[model samples]
Target: MERLQKVIAKAGIASRRKAEELILQGKVKVNGKVCTTLGTQVSSKDIISVDDKIIEKEELVYYLLNKPRKYVCTVKDEHKRNKVVDLIECKERIFPVGRLDYDSTGMLILTNDGDFAQMLSHPKFQIPKSYRVTVKGILDKNDLIKLQNGLVLDDGYKTMPAKVSMTSYDNTSNRCVLEMTINEGRNRQVRRMIEAVGKIVSKLHRMQYGCVKDDNLAIGSYRRLRPHEIKTLKKMANEGISE
Candidate 1:
């Protein structure tokens, strides 16, 4: 059994917070009776409907993709560009956990589980994400420090503080492999943070997100999350699924 608001939210009726409002307003009905209580508990056996629309339980799916550059991270593109789901080619609906810019690439988590999806994508969780970035010019100590700290983006929002280190470098080519760890996921964050510090990211590859790492997985190939990996992820998220 689960809270009625959570069941309503999982059914895609509304957010959990909003579902409570609907419930209190007498808009939700359980077993053909009005349920105006905020703390109602329900199960699959309980017939639930909102605004006369019967709720349907969607199948939960999880997928991992080594997203490649030039492919957008969305379920459907209005302009018909290739999307991340195009690579998976699965019937179970899935959505990208976080986003990778069109010019960036790396391990992307996809799932149809709405609760897991909300936890990973929302800012509160602050799931650590690591990136192996290649910069155009050699970044010095000052350059590294500024990117290590937060900054006001071009859009005017201050970036969250992060961890940065030089994993590899080439003085001759002026390119450096910098490992970046960020708790917050923002649009074009790693690239913009570096660029704001007077350098350009030539190539960006995500090495880790949350506790999961690519670990020699071939590009354009993917595999299921190992049992141990799933367990670790549940531990990190501080939540678990019935599966």
Candidate 2:
């Protein structure tokens, strides 16, 4: 069972807020009766209709894409630049669970499951995401410890403590490569965190999301998520596991 508004939103009938408005306006009917309350639990067998039209729920599908740089993560881009959704051929409408900046690349999940997306996105869940980052300046142990302890960003929001590990520092190229696993999802967060330490991010790529990794997937390639993988991710998110 799922929330009525979320189910309607996942069905592509309308946004969740719009679905709730329809429900409050008495335009949504469940099993032949109007349901105005939000958070109404509904099963697959429930007959749902909106504005007197029956809603057809799309089959829930999940895909893990090894996102390539230059492609936007949005379902539709107004500028018509490349979108990640175009990389996959699916009948059901799916959207990226979280966003990677236009230049950032790595493991990204796309799904039609609104609840699953919301669960992973909620900060309270603290879904662990790992990234490979290359920066301009070498960070010493104290700087890395600052990152591990948390740093205040430009916007005045302090980041949560992150798991940091040094990959390599090339003296010839003056670049520092490191792996950071953070559970919070903020806009351009990893970049901002590096900047907080007076370093500029030259490259950023996600290596893992929850237990899902980009091991065998090639750049711009995607595959349907296995049932067990999906189950494990859901479990991790619910349990706030940061591995």
Winner by TM-score: 2
Clashes of each: 0, 0
lDDT of 1 at 107: 89
lDDT score for residue 127 of model 2: 93
TM-score of each: 0.79, 0.87
For each candidate in turn, give its C-alpha RMSD to the true structure in angstroms: 4.7, 2.9
Q: lDDT for model 2, on a 0 to 1 scale?
A: 0.90
Cα shift from native, residue 155, model 2 (Å): 1.3
lDDT tens readout by residue for model 1, 1-243 = 999988876765555666889999999999999999887888889999999888888766667778888899877799888788778876666667779988788889877665666777777667888889999888899877787778888899888778899878898998888989988888888888988888899999998877788778876777666767666766666642211
Predictions in order: lDDT: 0.80, 0.90
Model 2 clash tally?
A: 0
Error of 1 at 144 (Å): 0.9
Error of 2 at 34 (Å): 9.1
